[model samples]
Target chain A: MQFSGDILIEDEFLRDGLQNEERIFTLAEKLEFLAALEAAGLRRIQVGSFVHPKWVPQMADTDALCEAMPRNEGVTYTALVLNGAGLDRALAVGLGHLSISISASETHSRKNTNRSVDEGRAAITPVIERALSEGVTVRAGIQSALGCGFEGRIDPARVIAIAREFAALGVQEINIADTAGLANPVQVFDLCRKLQDAIGPDVALSLHLHDTRGLGLANMLAGLQAGVRIFDAAMGGLGGCPFVPEATGNVATEDLAFACEEMGLATGIDWQKLRAPVARAEALLGRALPARQSHVPSPPWLREVA
Target chain B: MQFSGDILIEDEFLRDGLQNEERIFTLAEKLEFLAALEAAGLRRIQVGSFVHPKWVPQMADTDALCEAMPRNEGVTYTALVLNGAGLDRALAVGLGHLSISISASETHSRKNTNRSVDEGRAAITPVIERALSEGVTVRAGIQSALGCGFEGRIDPARVIAIAREFAALGVQEINIADTAGLANPVQVFDLCRKLQDAIGPDVALSLHLHDTRGLGLANMLAGLQAGVRIFDAAMGGLGGCPFVPEATGNVATEDLAFACEEMGLATGIDWQKLRAPVARAEALLGRALPARQSHVPSPPWLREVA
Candidate 1:
């Protein structure tokens, strides 16, 4: 009952959502999504991932995305960078906000990059330093923060240790990811609490969860109980890891916003407005999006109150 | 930290699972699904709903299903009854168990069944009494237990009152349903605790959650945490409600069981064997079932151990 008011949510649909599309959109189509994100009152959006074009052809437009993004005076548009090279490319395109990821599971880290987790960490630390040097706000992500399909359960201790390193490296934020949908509410709450305890409130705690096990929103609510103010979600549940194997989309942005808003927690988002991005993306994907809010009969309140 | 084991999940594919199929399965196909359910190690299942053929033509084969169901020892096959007439039909068909539903949201009750919550309750209480006299196990359900699209928020108090009344009527179980996916972990945990307070351990607590908002498994976890056992899920997530309009499928039974088994909980159901049911349903629906576990490769542990 104590939980109320608008909470900040970060939309990862562009970077995370584009993973599920059968047909990769033109850079223009991708920007259409970004413009919709801006119009939806979303304060933060991850527009593109800086992975190599050869590896993920869908995200080949990352450089162009940064240049073409709809500029909102207060909105934070982010480019997800892998290492220093990706960070440099994002920075050269006038991208001032950045996210770098390191997998908590060693197996996943090695699969994601040909390096071990520690090596991935070694690679990302300098990007954090460089982002700070360039005055680019950096949010360092601990992928597989909850569990891994390849390696199974990830150690919360490793996640905490990584967060401490990121905090020390002056990363602007820390996003903990349950990359494999293996997280439970207790684990999510516990991890968020521990990460916050280690890093304090200076770094925002952003949670990225998957719907793989039906714990996506449950885990988000648990993190909310642990005082996490930020979340990552996709439009129309479009996004999954090309590497995480069975991974589906991130928690859908509109669904998350609806849950938070209806529960009296403010998401600063209009759920009705959030549908546009997914609808736009549907043209690119051909198939309908996975899950959608029920279309039950007209709510009398919507008509009467308004 | 106390939660462990595979959660006990009951597949509802036969009864509530066939709401909007383009074509109803013949008694033979339905029998095949039941066959798969038994092989999946399902100890409990809802095989049919005794509603009017005109109202729900897809379920017109209720009596046929009762006759053709593969009789397996110790597997509890239940049927849904909407009114006294339906209950009479179920009793005539020799159903051992019955599930009766009353909505927590008055608006939904009126629109869905042309009765207010109290009137719907009135119409069903005698059915509960009549079923009990015949030694049939009657489980009362509070539908729209979370929130209703038409009604907005469902008061936990109303749900408790419905649950309390049903418990007093000698019902064998109480199912708290997120008829709409408007529940979060907090709401689920809190509501389950209240439901337990109203019904206690003598009457089993069941959950019928829809994945409309992707919170089905999360709500199920909340029920488990609150000491409620027994869950209702659909195979391959193949369901939507023609009654409610655009309702998503029940929680995926395989996905739920996998989550539960991995956590070391005793569900007494075989997770691996349930894949066939999913496959059969997918073929029947002429589309892929919407389940995360379906897309996943066999875990290395399973292969290594095998």
Candidate 2:
């Protein structure tokens, strides 16, 4: 159960974090935040989602963001695409990195994407192939992989089968999301182990966790024990699961980095630098966020050492 | 690791929860909450503390609380006794169970109890012996066992020595508390494993955690993986570390139970039964508490099944 290496965190604050927020930032504001995240030494950033403006107005400036933000040599900037139209927008906007996301649970797939799991699966086939052919690194993610509100507990076999399909299609990574925030440490360790075994170390595994039930960091610990290296988190714990209003969405990036650092895992990014962006988001949103460490002033002991 | 059996949780809301709150509950109110907790199936309840009321006015009515609350056949009611005087108070009130607690960090010991670590350790010797001699079940706890605000991190050897002394005194159990909420998952796992090995399972191991850095439940998970069962949690996330105002104290009792139940561990208490008491506390305090599961109305899926 030793964590041997550095973990790569993909900052999803711009996409998943802002999507559910009622206050939509302008293109300039979004770009400035992106630059700040990059300056904070984040290697991967989910800049935006190519979703319709009507459905998710917060992400309406996806094309504008991709067009304006400067690309860095070492950084990987990705955007989420749910269907063919969203994919077309990503390609049209010259998105260099892409994620094709669908739910593993049939009920969640139908309600969220208005398609059956099979249809959603079949639809992403061409998207993955096209992205690969276009020299784009693709990440295939299964939402509600652990459990769903409407579907109760999702079967490990079903999530594994979807990951196998994505692995066969040559996607760079496979992501498992606890969309309903129902995963416990035991369940997370079990699923991560099985997924790693099924994928055979060829495809990278990522975990997207929620703190809805206050188990986000705990699940992340279990994932680390299971040898997972990539995690998706939002700054200031900005997002909330749309399905569960009171449920805080993605794990806070600063909190996760702090926890990882404390565990002797390298995260490259400075945990202290996360507070500025978190404060900015809080002021922009005009509310106190739920991330614990961000709200705390650095004590003298930590400050002196840092 | 598989978690097969049940876990015992000590409800510390009445004591630790209120001690840190600015609002104080009346003796009648405290008794009403105690009855509700018993009805909720909590086997172990820390009703109040035997601290000087002048120092901590919130626990001023501990005597009245202990005298009024009805005792159940299977339930074990406990009070925290910080010194010999506190132990005498407990004996006078007929409190059956008592916890002798002091800090593992010397700096924290000096600040909190006005004594050095060694002095605090020496002071508890006769307290433990007296409690045991009088047929009282004694739980010896080491506060700030993981890390400290005044002292950055506590040495495992220091904590282990304290536990050894308590074990030699024939205490019923030994508790390791994350008093400053400075613990991470790795620290928790290591300390729990070391304490369990040193105590040799004859003395039951318990953990008292605070959600100061949002790692309370995560630490709880790591502790579970390390095979420690008994936990101390507060209802409605009602407390914060007195040393750090921003640091939320105990893990919310309802949240821990819900997380344990999700992980297939029986907590004896139903998660659904937690809200009424949480609401009562919130109303009495006239504020919204930080507990997550308490605020979330149980959806149909969880309700029908439970």
Candidate 3:
């Protein structure tokens, strides 16, 4: 299997990374992370989500954070929006890119969004249409596309069907998420390949993976082999599945970049520059994160190999 | 990229896992761990290394541990030996399987074993010969075969040449080690394929990987794609390279087994049974280990996926 020549990394540290944590980052701290991410040459970043403060207290200041964020050239700053109200909030902040996602598992949809699978899809349709009519970049996402903690073994056919609907709605990208970290390499490769075939390459495919079972990077490697070039990662691996107790975070941004760069794929990410932010995050959390690359010194062979 | 249907796992938690930690396990605790491992269906285990206590104090009781270890049916117990003296000690205990290894990097060889590459090879030749004459199963190892901390970018040809020498010595297996955690997936696949071609199918190949940079399992996936079926892992991801500060441990045995089992490969090991021992190790170490599988609950999809 041939790998892509370059990879696109979208860091979701402020959003997914912090949403599940008990200690919330203030607006100032979020901006600090944003500046560091931009300076480190990360082209895509998810600032926060526009969910209700009552539901997700950590994301209460997404609008203020987005308004305060600098608009760097060549960098696309996005936020997650789950409904029309969240879309209105994101658009009010003049955000160009927005992620609107629904869960494939009916049980997960009900638990996460208080809507059944059909209800969730119906609710997001108008949000996507409104975003598209306003010329906003829409990244349609399918959560629990690989598997779910509540409803195990989400069918690939269901995921592809959801993608087909999102494609017909004229979205620019489709992101398949292994929300519960239940995906293996073979399942990832198979589902990704089938999705690519069904989507016919018009809509870009990206993956949002979690590292709960220690197969996150391995599954990412399989996704790469299946022709996926874009991935969502979090700094310091700081995220967990709120639905699954003790589930780990997304793949670490530095670790993902290191793996890609080591395999001759240009990620345009400076892993060395990520250390300060990761260290700050660790200090603030008063605990160590699950990230490996940020903690260890760069090996001497990376320069020679990459 | 065809994976082998059956995989072999050699757990080295007792040796590589504990050697670098400050805490030491008594003979009784080690026996408990050994019993747990045997009950968990581990076929091959590396109990400890026959090194001088002055260097690795944690392994000071290896001889006594070996003598007291029960000879379970269908289980192959082994220990590491660095020279003729270590070999003699291992022989004195009647260890059926012994691992004799050298470093591929000249600088690492000098630092780790206090000998040049040639001298290290010359010193181990008689040990290998003696072990062969005693009808012991010899697993010849090449450390820093992928890259080194002291001297970076070890040539794959050098690793192949060493494997050839080991094969000529009539060793049963050749284990390639990424001593400094500098190996990438492409490098691992290419080197393992070349080593397989050079050493032929008669000599088995196993990989000893570290998760220092978080590429261990990904590299293991690449090795599997390259047709390697045997791997060395530590429970609770307990091993670290003594030469590299802040370097992490080996790939977790449960994590590796979970991945293999998820990918339709039979590992003949029960990952669930490993939790008790891993928890014990964590408690004894007074810290959380780098293992993901032992911390998280088994996903409901594993039963359906596998």
Q: Name the best candidate (by TM-score).
A: 2
Task: Give residue B244's error in model 2 in angstroms.
Answer: 4.6
Q: State the lDDT of candidate 1 residue by residue for B1-306, as single tens digits.
A: 347644557788887787578778899888888888887788888888888888789899989889877667888888888888898789888888888887888877887678988899898888889899999988888888887866677889889988989999998889888776667766887888878877877988888888776667767766777787788888777666666664677788877777676556878766667666777777777878767676565444554532
Span of ten consecutive residues with least summed lDDT in model 1 chain A: A294-303
lDDT ranking from best candidate downward: 3, 2, 1
Quote the positional error of residue B231 for candidate 2 in Å.
0.5
- In model 3, pairs of residues that clash are none
| lDDT of candidate 3 over B1-306, digit per residue (tens) | 235478889999999998888888899999999999888889999999998899889999999999999998899999999998899899999999998999998988887799998898888888999999999999999998998876778988888988999999999999999878888898999999999999999999999998888888899999999888999999899997576554468999999998998888998998888888898888888988889888877787554533
Residues A1-306, model 1: lDDT tens digits: 347756888888888888556578888787777778778788888888888988888888888878776678989888788888888798899888888888988888888887898898888887889888999988899998888888777778888999999999888789999887778777787788889999988888889988876668878877887888889988777778888876876788877887776556887776666655666667667767754541223233443522
Q: DockQ of all candidates, in order?
A: 0.39, 0.64, 0.63
Better by TM-score, candidate 3 or 1: 3
Candidate 1 displacement at residue A95 in angstroms:
3.2
Question: What is the per-residue lDDT of model 2 for residues B1-306, given as tens digits with 9 covering 90 to 100?
Answer: 578789999999898888887778899898888888888889999998888888788899998888888888989999999999999999998887998899887877886789999999999899899999999999999988888776677889999989998998899899999887888888888888888898888999999998988899999998998898999998887776555454576899889998888788899987677788888777778888888888765543586744
Task: Give the whole-model CA lDDT for all candidates, comma-separated.
Answer: 0.79, 0.85, 0.89
Q: List, in order, the clash count of every candidate structure.
A: 10, 0, 0
Q: What 10-residue stretch in candidate 3 chain A is worst by lDDT?
A: A297-306
